[model samples]
Target: MRYRDENKVLAIREAAIDMVASDGLENFGINRLAKAAGVSPATIYIYYKDKEDLLTSISIEEGVKMTRATLKGFDPNMSFKEGLWVQWQNRAAFSLDNHKSAEFFEQLRNSTYKDKMLETINDEFRKNMGNFVENAIERGEIERMPLEVYWSVAFAPLYSLIRFHNEGKSLGGRKFKFSEKIMKETFDCVLKGLTK
Candidate 1:
């Protein structure tokens, strides 16, 4: 085999993300991935154990980035609303600027491998998020509920808007855009409903 090249691994990852996003997960295969990456199937084996391993790698790498981006400016001492606003902004910007990573994430989150990917996410990032949520509940800033519910309430809308904006789609003939006004309104509405 030729000397190992890190660029080949990165190309494989990029191709995997694009392929997974464009085609359903079930349709993805080593031959197609190799062709897309311009690398041989044997080379992929050198870098990854199998398709599952490569997919898991993508999940962990992108998951950490998205998690770190989501937690940018997160402060347990700050009001829950302030933290949420910061989260919204970070996530929106990350998704808009890194569409491939964002799409890879969205696809993975909705795939059968989601549970396994979640299990492998960075523990430090998970703990920080948990601490923020627990602190909010203890402070009586939000009602007691599963962390997933709280997150869905806080971010699902923002994700929808970002998706529309990325696709340049219009809602009733008006192009979708993310703005401070939209962010503030979303934060207010979602936070108010969660508050005690």
Candidate 2:
């Protein structure tokens, strides 16, 4: 029997994410990931049932980390606009701070386990988020709409910018300059349309 250090597990998780990001899921292989992580394939099997299972676990972990970062310093009782700005700031900071992890998250969004990972987020975080939405609606800060719509309206712009920024190219392949100014302006534009 051989010891499986937890760091090796972390390495495996990160390497798997990097592999999928660079190679796409179709080209991702456990053998290649093992070499990248400096661990054997058997070590990965010990932790995850299979490639699908490993990707699922990584998806869950990344979502939780990003969710937690987004929730920190979040106060549902704040003025509606302030709360929305805070959430945007948190999200932007996370995306900028963890470039590789954010890219991995982008890849996971297209994975088969995407919905499963989203449906299984931390219960407390989910509940708090629900409460925030409900409270905002009750206060008439936002229009009556499904949570999905709210999520799309609020975070979609930031994510769109993050994606392009991460790739260092615009959707049209033009040179693009990214700045905090653009993010704040984009948030204001989205917020104005969402508010009553």
Per-candidate RMSD, Å: 2.4, 2.2
List, residue by residue over 165-185, the lDDT tens digit for candidate 1: 777775775777777787678
How badly does each model clash, as a count of residue pairs? 0, 0
Give the TM-score (vs. native) of candidate 2: 0.86
Residues 145-175, candidate 2, lDDT per residue (tens digit)? 8878888998888988887887788877977
Q: Which stretches of candidate 2 lie over 4 Å from their true place?
A: none
Best by lDDT: 2
Q: Can you list the residue pairs that collide in candidate 1? A: none
What are the lDDT scores of the predictions, listed in order? 0.81, 0.83
* lDDT, model 2: 0.83
**Model 2 residue 170 lDDT score:** 83
The ten-residue window of minimal lDDT in model 2 covers 100-109
The alpha-carbon lDDT assigned to residue 159 of candidate 1 equals 81
Angstrom error of the Cα, residue 159, model 1: value is 1.5
The candidate 1 region of ten consecutive residues with least summed lDDT is 169-178
